[model samples]
Target: MTLDIGTQHRDASVSGPSSDLSPSPPSSPGLVSTHAAAVSPAPARKPTTASNAASTSAILSWSDEKVKSCSSLRARKDLRRNLEVDVLQNIQKALRTSPNPFFNDPGAAAQEALRQAQIYKAWIQDQEGSSLEVAIVNDHPQGPADGCPPYDFVWVNGYVHDDTIPPSDPSELQGCDCEDDACNPATCKCFQKAVRFDTLNIYKESKQFAYNADGTLQDMMVPTYPIFECNSKCGCSSACTNRVVQKGRRVEIEFFKHQHYGWGVRARHRIKRHTFIGIYSGELVSDAEADRRAIVYEDVGSTYHFTIDPHPIKLETMRKRLASSPEGRTMTEEQLMQRVNDWTRLMDLYQAHREHKVTAKQLKEFNDRQIVEAKRKGEWSRRWQAELEAELAEWEARYREEPDNYLSLEPEDQARAEDLSLFYEDQQEANELTVDGALHGNFTRFFNHSCDPNLATWPVWIEEGSIWRPFFCFFALRNIEAGDELNFSYTSAEEVDDMVKRLNQIQVEQGTKPGTKRMKCLCGASNCRGFVFG
Candidate 1:
């Protein structure tokens, strides 16, 4: 599904509901289908001789005015940066308490929201006085009755409710008898019900879990497990081994608008694997309600209805059955770690070269050798090579112009330069578990879709009497640096054939040009499939 929020309006339009948005089909297994809307082309108008001459004159005048305007804007933006930094620092300082004080009290939450709004108002100058208020609230903006409903933010526990059906009674809590700090799979009743993990609490049937532990799942296509954490009913401490997701967010995150993909979420600090990011909270509606809203959203090209279909137990059983086959086994954990280390070293070297700490000859030789190796492995792309070369050239020019100033950099400045690029570059759609935030959701709703997502979603179940719903929790799939946008795949397949087919059908029905019906993907991944919807 494509979420195209037009720059002209605060309201977002959806292309269609995601396949997962509806009831899961029996045949597709992990694959969920999503809808895409028809895009109509604007009619072209004939320009008269007088209009053409006048247009040319206007273009020239606008060009001159734009340059001066941009320069002045840049200066003003720089002046505001110090104040912005101070505000952010103060906010961070205030939020240094454990368990996030904002979640504990309404006053604290409002204060935080107000501070965030100030920062957002300054950053998004063009959006001042707009209805889309930038605040750290726990609830999404309420929509109309026929539209999506508002929902409160769920911290650790999951909430399940369908508007079409009568709400089910909350599930009763059944506590385990284990008295250990952390529950042992050998004796814990809750752990005994688990089919995927062994007595040691380690995944029993696959090497994928091991690879994830070593931070090597970045490039590999692996299926994620439906993680069931120790809930409040468990006789374990908060620091229990199986209590990762329930611990709440450990890293700071921000929601901001992107130049291409409307609004997006970003990390404010470096994040590690298995760390709790946030919960995908929103109104829980039935498949019928989701479909109805989806059709309404499609009229305006809005697509943000995510389905909650956990990875079926049968799928994991199938993977285990295939594990004995040659094709089923992935790289060894040691080999994966080695590859990650090699990439990190290469990036460090590149940074050194850019800083002029390494000679030009050294940089060129390393680049040439890597290019050859990458080509031999069929891992190189012309687009990436050109981008790298251009960046290097730009850096060289900047260094020559300001040698001393550029070399004397702050710690954050150095870190920013080294961590600008994303960690992964591949796409997978089948394993994605999602929640729809099209009409109403918190900051997490702004996270854009990426082929090479650095974040992964995990299911968290907290015992709340008779309520047993899975909170779709996100975590850093690998180490992610500050300033990097958080992303995840919206589709389950790497191919764009389905997306293209939908676009073509829409174009034919709308009587528009074939190629002009689809939205271009702004995700700069090398393996991007052209359009974001696929």
Candidate 2:
């Protein structure tokens, strides 16, 4: 995916990265850096197929990059194991009609796959470091050429302090339940530092999977959002005043949003505008950990880096058809069947097919097969293709039905939901933002990015599920039309001068102030902010 680097939409919410030589002030309690909150995870969900030995090796090498740097080592192992199981499952399913099942032997396939995985890991460690992270694995045969594998790897730098040292070898580090004090390495003062690599490298070894040219992992592109940490007690309402707590951390800083801008809670249902979403709940995993626990969703026949929502579309097509039918209640079975057939046929016609031609040899083989055999093969292929196409169409339709509401169901949605919900609940309870963990305000998701915006961010405290939390609350600068794309200033309204400075810097970057990209602003508002916020 192409990043809109030149536009304000990309940098609006989060502050730009601080210079390496100077660190920003320590974030106030109840607030954290936006840069720490939003992360574009590695892409391990997508896979590809290979036909020859070289292609298979390329696919394995490609997938290795994506699986290596997952948060936890355990997760990465599990993911690789799961991938092997998926291959075994497909092999077994394929063997159902074979005279012998040697090729379908799970144990044999697993052994071979595992050996390959170990070798791949060794190769990566030799080129990169001892620890690596995998972000994406491309396994399709029709992907890009130029020796790119189907996966990308993110390498993590491990730091060890002089005063205290972790295990001489990470492999010897005993696993402890995070819930226990033993898991708190902080107690031991053991200096173990791990840092993620910034550069993305694809193996490009095979066309089947998404991989870089050098057997490294490519970044799973993520939509960036400006995140704000509440620095002091705040609320969407102006009447609310800042106050330091009598005890505990003083609540400060609020992220920005839109719903609370004008009507506040009156503008929405179920959740109030700027209300808390949910807290992060998944296991903390790096590339290695994620790969280790990577359990392939058994039903899907592949490894899914993120949680899979098994909820089927359960399409309402039948109901829609029934509603449109005339004299529907009194229709005969044949009539109903005819309607169903017509709809099915129409759907089939609309489905996209690979224009690539089939081989004459394959076609001839099909003709030579027994009638029953040929029919079974044809039915299997047709049904398989149809189901895949149908699911894709349903997903697309869902996105169209309500882009904001439905897009949240994508893989990244679960993580964002937890972050937003946690921010709100924490505020209501403790009257502060979460300071110890990452916080995310996915406003760009629903609000849409704008060079100009009509809302400002405010921090609020809320309680949820018996915990106090902080949230970045959005307030309106003006009464907005119902359908106008909701936008909030990425910079704080309280700090207008700084905002102008930031905007000026962006203009300079884009050559608008001095350089020369010279793209016209698309924000139609009369008072569109001239530049995107970082």
lDDT for each candidate structure: 0.39, 0.25
TM-score of each: 0.44, 0.21
Q: Which regions in candidate 1 have their CA more than 4 angstroms from the true location?
A: 1-116, 119-165, 168-173, 196-202, 205-223, 313-435, 464-468, 495-517
The candidate 1 region of ten consecutive residues with least summed lDDT is 48-57
- Tens-place lDDT digits, model 2, residues 1-534: 000110011211111121111112222311211111111212222233111000111233223333332323212333332244234333322322233334234344333233333333333333222232211111221111101122222111111011111112323222212333222223211111100001121111211111122211123311111111112122222211111111111111122222111111112212222222221111222222222322221111222121111101001223234546576567754455455444433332222111112233434344212221122111111222223223223333323232233232445644444443344333322221111010011111123224455544332222211111122334344444433444543223333344354445655655655221122233455665443321
Per-residue accuracy of model 1 over 453-496 as CA lDDT, tens digit each: 77766554555322223565676777789768887665545334
Q: List residue ranges in candidate 2 displaced over 4 A.
A: 1-446, 451-454, 463-469, 475-480, 493-521
Number of residue pairs clashing in candidate 1, backbone atoms closer than 3 angstroms, sequence gap of 3 or more or interchain: 19
Residue 432, model 2: Cα distance from true site in angstroms: 13
| Best of the candidates, TM-score | 1
